[model samples]
Target: MKEQTLPIIDTDVHHSPDKKEVLAHMPKALAARGLALPGGNGFGNPHGVNRRDATPPGGGEACSDPAYTLEHHFVPNQIRYGILHPAGLLAAGVSADYRYAAALCSAYNDYMLESWLSFDPRYVGAILVAPNWPEAAAREIRRLGGRPEFREIIMTSASESPLGREQYWPIYEAACEMGLPVAVHPGAEGNGISNRPYAGMPSSYFEWHTSLSQNYMGQIASLAIEGVFNQFPELKFVAIEGGIAWLPHLLWRLDKNWKALRELTPWLTEPPSELIRRHVRLTTQPIEEPEKPEHLLQIFDMIHAEETLMFSSDYPHWDGDDPRFVLPRKLDEAARKRIFYDNAAELYGLPPQESTVSEEAANSATPTN
Candidate 1:
């Protein structure tokens, strides 16, 4: 019997809006207050932001041009639906002025709807909400959360404090009330705005990237300890671009400590590991590639990949994974179906859509990372 094919539903495709497009959405008054759009923000990324070759033929940054992106990724990869994780704009989460940050997020969402979602039915927008001001963020979610294109609330993973704090609970409450999942994608670390590592900033980019799991670990632990899962049982979180290998270690430590320290926090109704498995979902980009396939499989087993893992391409980034080969070869057809399509489809409540890309069209366009 022939193996079954699945329609790819990518959860973590990044798209940076053209500066002009973002500016068009920004109010002239707010634009003057340093609502820096996309590439205009002065923060330097030493390795540059995207894959150099991904620049659209129309003359803009990678993932900026929706038409080129469709030709390069969605068509070739047969991605029927994608969650647009807006790049660069998420730094608003750590902005100095809460009002300015909120405005920037609103502008970014408008830009996404105009420049990306309106262009294709396959694309969905993330409502960028600055968590620094929880009430404002909640207001934004209330305003736009009901839209069909704006399906999820996107916030930067890097923040002044752990996301589980009561101050941030309003954002999650709004998300739950609106019936959307909260996606916390990774961003720059050690930049003086985000939560810092226990040891302080790493000396090199390689060290910084390698230690990103620390950020996720800290946030997840905070959520568990603060009883976020207990407070909002229906809420779901998607952690994108953070590798999954550290999950097992974090879970093990959380359970071990909870057993001895259960009295300190009486709110936890279940083990932290169990809560994570039930409430959290992780993306598989920058997957923990081990020397041996067995080692990778071991990591998956420990984390219960089938229950939590979802497919993410991180498209147009230098380290983006391709849907065609991101999964380990050892995964059976059922696991592949769950990761690449079913998990995300169910999580986002996306309706099944027929594949519109023909084999000839998919083959005619070359694939880009």
Candidate 2:
């Protein structure tokens, strides 16, 4: 029997927008000043971060040209939908000037809506919010959240404090009101005004990248223990580009600690792990490769992956995963379908694809030996 093709909803497709274009949308005073977004940690990738071949034929940065990206990435990969997370401005959430950060975010969103999301129906937008200014971020969410193209709210994982703090609650409130999930992507860690890793800053991009998941672990634990989910039951969060191997371990430790110290927080009526399972979803990219592939599958089961894991290509980045070979072949078709399409479709409230519906029906009707 020929293998069936599954629909893909890539949750982390990145596009690098030109700064001038983004600035064009900003207030004339800021645009005239030519302010740039905050820079990343000095630990640089000596060989660079983007794939060489991903550059557009028209001579722009990789993933910068919407048409080229659609032709090269979406068509070739058979991606039914690609969530656009603008690359360069992800660090705006960490800027010291909260007002400036908020303005930059608004400009970037306008640029994205005009340049990328409008270029194709397949492209979906994630509303960029400045976490430092919760009110401003909330305003931005309220401004753009009702749009059909915009499906999720995004902020950088790098921050002065854990995301669950009361300061960030307004953003969550707006997201819930808009029926959108909040997503945290790592790009500003140890950069600008954001706090460094708990273990202190790493010396190289390699070291920094390896420890990226630490921020996610901290954020997820904070959200659960602080009762963020309890306050906004409708809110959902996507931790983009953070590897999944650490999830099972983090939840295990969280559950054990909660059991021993239930008195510390009276509001938590259930285990931290249960709260995390219900509110958090993660993308699979830069997926952990254990010595035995089966070990990865075991991790998936521990985390209830079918309900929590979503597929992300992190496209055009040097370390991006190819949907074709990212998952283990041993994964059953049902699980594969959920990760590849269903989980994201449900999370983003995307309509069911006709192809996917027909494919499911065909599979169910086939006779088995």
Candidate 3:
């Protein structure tokens, strides 16, 4: 019998273009404000840098041209690396030109459907939406409903409205109705200006990247305690680009608070941890370093229950870990099967993998670390 090749899907893969590429289709009035147009360059992330010093073992030159790379090199590289479902760029914050932001976002989403995800049945995409305007976001969600290529809805973790608030419920409800997963991807410092936190982490970029996940954890935990998931049981949430080790800590703290405030928020029928177990999913990307494979297993064993962790490559980000190098080494065959492919395929509703990664499998099939 022939062995099954693991069909992997990377969920948190981000495809945000530098300002210039994002404004490519803005309107005349809005295009003028887009960086792609003349004299339109004001936004930049203050804390972002590619100190990677080099690419992940097998990752090629996707960084040089992500917008075009996904169309050519990206998917082929993912396929060669044993990854099948490569979700790229569709979820990026493309509304940089605020005036025509919605139009720009629609064009980008359409492009994802036609240009990238449409390029291959195995590739999936997350539709980018601005939480700042819930009504407009709802419209986009409705627009893309049931599109096979667009299975997840991606948005920034930071928003004008607290994620737990009712103002965002319409967008949440729309996604649930459509059976799409709502995913939060953390953006950089210029992604939004924060009065707090950034003040202390001035010197280190790692400080911000690590803290970014915690910020989303805080918001998602707040929503869980606030009964967001309870109200929308069909709605699945994904907290992406953060490592999974923090899950136990965040869940422990959330459970602790709920114990005291059960009366305050009666809608929470179960503990915060239970809610996460049910409707929430977290992505593994930009991993923290560990000394050995056992070291990683110990971490996942405590914080994530195999299926809870999804595969992600912060593709094209200078420091984005090569999926091939960062994933296969840390997990055993069963664990790798799910994190690297199974869970992601299930998340995006794609075809399943034929085999799992074994101890010696990395040498033969070349699983992403």
Q: Which candidate is the best by TM-score?
A: 2
Alpha carbon lDDT of residue 25, candidate 1? 72
C-alpha RMSD of candidate 3: 6.6
Task: Give the per-residue lDDT of model 1 (tens digit) for 187-230.
Answer: 65554366666468666666676778889989989988899989
Better model by lDDT: candidate 2 vs candidate 3: 2
Instruction: Write down the TM-score of every candidate.
Output: 0.91, 0.94, 0.77
* Residue-level error in angstroms, candidate 2, position 52: 1.1
RMSD to truth, every model: 3.8, 5.4, 6.6
Which regions in candidate 3 have their CA more than 4 angstroms from the true location? 1-5, 16-24, 36-99, 189-204, 291-295, 328-330, 354-369
Model 2: worst 10 consecutive residues (lDDT sum): 360-369
lDDT of 2 at 157: 95
For 174-259, candidate 3 gives per-residue lDDT tens digits of 99888888887665333333213333434445556557665766677767876888889888888877677777788888899889
What lDDT is obtained when candidate 3 is compared to the true structure?
0.61
lDDT of 2 at 220: 92
Give me the displacement of residue 169 in model 2, in angstroms. Answer: 0.3
> Which residue pairs clash in candidate 1?
none
